[model samples]
Target: MITDTIEKLVAKATQLVHLFNYCELCEQPIYQQVALCDHCVSLIPRFQLDSLSGDLLNRPEIYGLYSKCVFDHLIAISPYQYPMSDWLKQFKYLGRWQYQRLCCRVLNFHLNELLKLSDFCPPDIVMPVPIHINRWQHRGFNQTLPLARTVAKVFKVHCNADCLVRQNQTGSQAQASGQLRRKQLKNNFALLPNETSYETSNEVTGKRVKLEGMHVALVDDVVTTGATVSEISRLLKAANVAKVSVYCLALSL
Candidate 1:
């Protein structure tokens, strides 16, 4: 009986260590495993697609003045405003890995609602926007990978990080203008070897995977000019992916 009691105490201690009880923003004790407390969550600006102009939804060719390319749909959890912007900076730049759970929960909730829409369909595969090996080594993680995996789990779909490979060590896109970002990212990604066979291989054969009828969702942390996702969507389309959708945690508006 004492051994069982000790084990129970140890398990509880572990749970407490992992549990997030305080709001990331205000540092107040919260009841749930969320990053932000209820007040902060409500204060953050959410992207309401329904309230936006129909042109933003139906047109697809242009989001404001920025021209979108091959991606057919765009879904963002929140606008790049206020606390969200701060949260993203902490999560990505400052390496607050715990923030991922909160971000994923928000994205997953929004994605579920999106899937209910008449024209929307769940993707066959979910992929994180790949980072170059050198970049990943520097960061110790691809920020989008966790978000993508969480989303894939929610949708019950495959999350294939290897399906898309970033070949170039292009520097940060954060400071670049839209045109420059596009120019830099062009031809930076390629399909993984033996992608179609669903097998992992190290050989970098020139043979491309045939995504003939598959719908793919590209996951990223943020969308600024739509340049990065657009370039990736172009490549996916070139490889015969039937549809490409871009999902981001926030959109810079």
Candidate 2:
């Protein structure tokens, strides 16, 4: 009990430090409850959670960054090809936060098609697949995190960035088969031990993580073959998260 209290204090202190260090890029007060500014906040495309079903879901695409372009309950948006294509270079790599908002808005816009079916549901919490510690240390940020956090905030649900964490370093997935890629990423995450217990908190994925069933919405910046999300989803299922629905800003075409 004492240790948990101390950890919470430390986490709060760190968050405060980050908050103070964060300057309003536009001098607009930076009042985002998540990490976005008002400009980014206003740009998110409105989406209906119930519109993802179609012929595409039934037939599922077979290749090119998307083996299954559409899920019976999943809809995705990718403005351009990935691995830092021009569009992604501008929005994801160049800190063009507005484009992040636009991408998410588009994802939301297409949600109606998937949700029309009953088997799918929006994730209870939005969790970005965490970066390897080494890369996160080098890059200074996980490019996908801000957008994922923003998506969670929009739905007024909890975002569990810490619940599932990445521990191993890895090579990029640019030139691998889908099955080989998933094997490469297998066993990459485990439930984190430091935060508040899922049981006591008023968080999303409301089911108990270590003990009972949970349903989660896994978020990512872009998914290429989905090896990363599938690996983590497997880990979460081992930890007993009942359902793992995925959401992404873009799907490489």
Evaluate model 2: give its lDDT: 0.57
Candidate 1: residue 134 lDDT (0-100): 89
If scored against the real structure, what TM-score would every candidate get? 0.77, 0.62
Best-performing candidate as measured by TM-score: 1
Cα deviation in Å at residue 59, candidate 2?
3.9
Task: Mark the regions of model 1 whose C-alpha exceeds 4 Å error after superposition.
Answer: 1-43, 50-56, 59-64, 197-210
Candidate 1 global TM-score = 0.77
Per-residue C-alpha lDDT of model 1 across residues 121-208, encoded as one tens digit per residue: 6777788998889888998899999889877877776678877888898887788998898899889888875664342233645444
